[model samples]
Target: MIDRFLDRLAALVEPTILALVIILLAWIVLRLTRATIQRAVARALQSERLSAREEAARVRTLTTLAESAVRLTVILLALLTILSIYGVPIGPLLASAGVVGLALGLGAQTLIRDVIAGIFIVLEDQYHVGDVIHVNNVSGSVEALTLRYTALRTLEGAYVIVPNGEIRIVQNLSRDWARAIIDVPLVPEEDVDRIIDILRPLLAALPSDPELGPLVLEPGEVFGVESIGQQQATIRIAVKTRPREQWRVARELRRRILYALREAGISAPYPRTVMIFHPSSPQPPASS
Candidate 1:
């Protein structure tokens, strides 16, 4: 009985241990690759002349994506290795998988499309995680971008998950520089061209302001009167700013312009108050 047990152990134990070793080695390699990928990403991010927060965020995003891909490959390799150890012919197995994949493709074409689209999106750098984009009619900031889906958080604090394939057009608001636009209302009594001229010099001098130098990319521009109203006309001022700085620039520009207007004694149009008299009122009506 002892001899028989020893023979059985020799036949199975050695190969099982060898297979375990191979799997461990594969895992080690996977970890190394993950580390290397992460380091490369970090280096690339650091070399960029971006803000500290942006650099860190970009590195984090690249690392997460790389890790996710590596993990998926490891899982697939492990499964294939196990199948090989069980004497499954890999060639036949792969051929059968191809057929099965074709069937799945027909059934879930949208899923495949989404995955492909997602790959292009990441590769092209159309938008990244934490970017604010307008996809189709939906506008949100990206929380996460995966191969199959994208996670977004709207301005209203609502979270949305959309399949990548469904995004027909993407308007990335956080790409390079954003525009800060403010419409100032002035009474029709004021000259539009004169108001523009007054603002142009002030706008040109924006880049010279030390406190606001970093946030603004260039000077602002008066885009002309966007609309004319009964009470007042609206003149639009557009200021270009670094990504994510548009809102802040808009607020600051508005404040500065308001102060300038006040200092120049340029008054805004106040709401017109009209008094109405009824037929029964005692007030006499002006007549010829």
Candidate 2:
């Protein structure tokens, strides 16, 4: 009875110790892999000129992807080792996995393509979160970026999700700088040169104002009479500004122009309508 008990204890203790060792090794390797990946990413991003918040976001995105890949590899290796330790033949399992993987590859090709495209986008720095971009005929500010899709918040408050694979062209609207070009329509009878002169003072003072000056990189310049029509003439006002600031600057300019023009007794152009009373048309009753 004693000999049988000793044999049973020995049989159980060896496999338990071996299994624990295998698990420990797997854990150590996972930690090392993660550390290495993080170190590599840090080194790669050292030369990138990014703001503190932007850098953090970029780091988070890339590291999350790297860690996910590492975790999958570690899990697969650990699972295989454990199965082998239990006397399960891995050769047939691997063969079956390859066949299934091929089938899944065919089924999820678009998913794979999207992830690959996303990786390239991140690497190339084509665009980032908070950038107003145009892709796949949709224009919006990027709200979030992932390995599969990009989320955008439109000006009208609509959220759009675009698959990375479908993004053939990426037009970044807010990159280093932005320009605002506005057409102000006026009476065709007004002198083009005189209108430009009237707008000159407002344009000159724009870049010197405290609040808006920072947003404006260049003072506004009015291009006289962009086009002439029967009723109105289009005057072009252009300004270079910091990224995303052009909208605010443009709005402010419009407000100032409207008030100034009103003070100067100049009227903007608008469509005119006339009512023709024909014989069959109804007319107002005559006062008694």
Best by lDDT: 2
TM-score, candidate 1, is: 0.77
Per-residue lDDT value at 235 in model 2 = 92
Compose the digit string of candidate 1's lDDT tens values, residues 92-137: 9889999999999999989999999988887777777878888867
Q: lDDT of model 1 at residue 143?
A: 92
Ten-residue region with minimum lDDT total, candidate 2: 51-60
Q: What are the lDDT figures for the candidates, one per model? A: 0.84, 0.85
Q: Model 1, residue 64: what's the lDDT?
A: 74
> How close is each model in CA RMSD to the real structure?
5.0, 5.7
Q: Which stretches of candidate 1 lie over 4 Å from their true place?
A: 1-16, 39-67, 86-96, 191-198, 265-267, 273-288
Work out how many backbone clashes candidate 2 has: 0
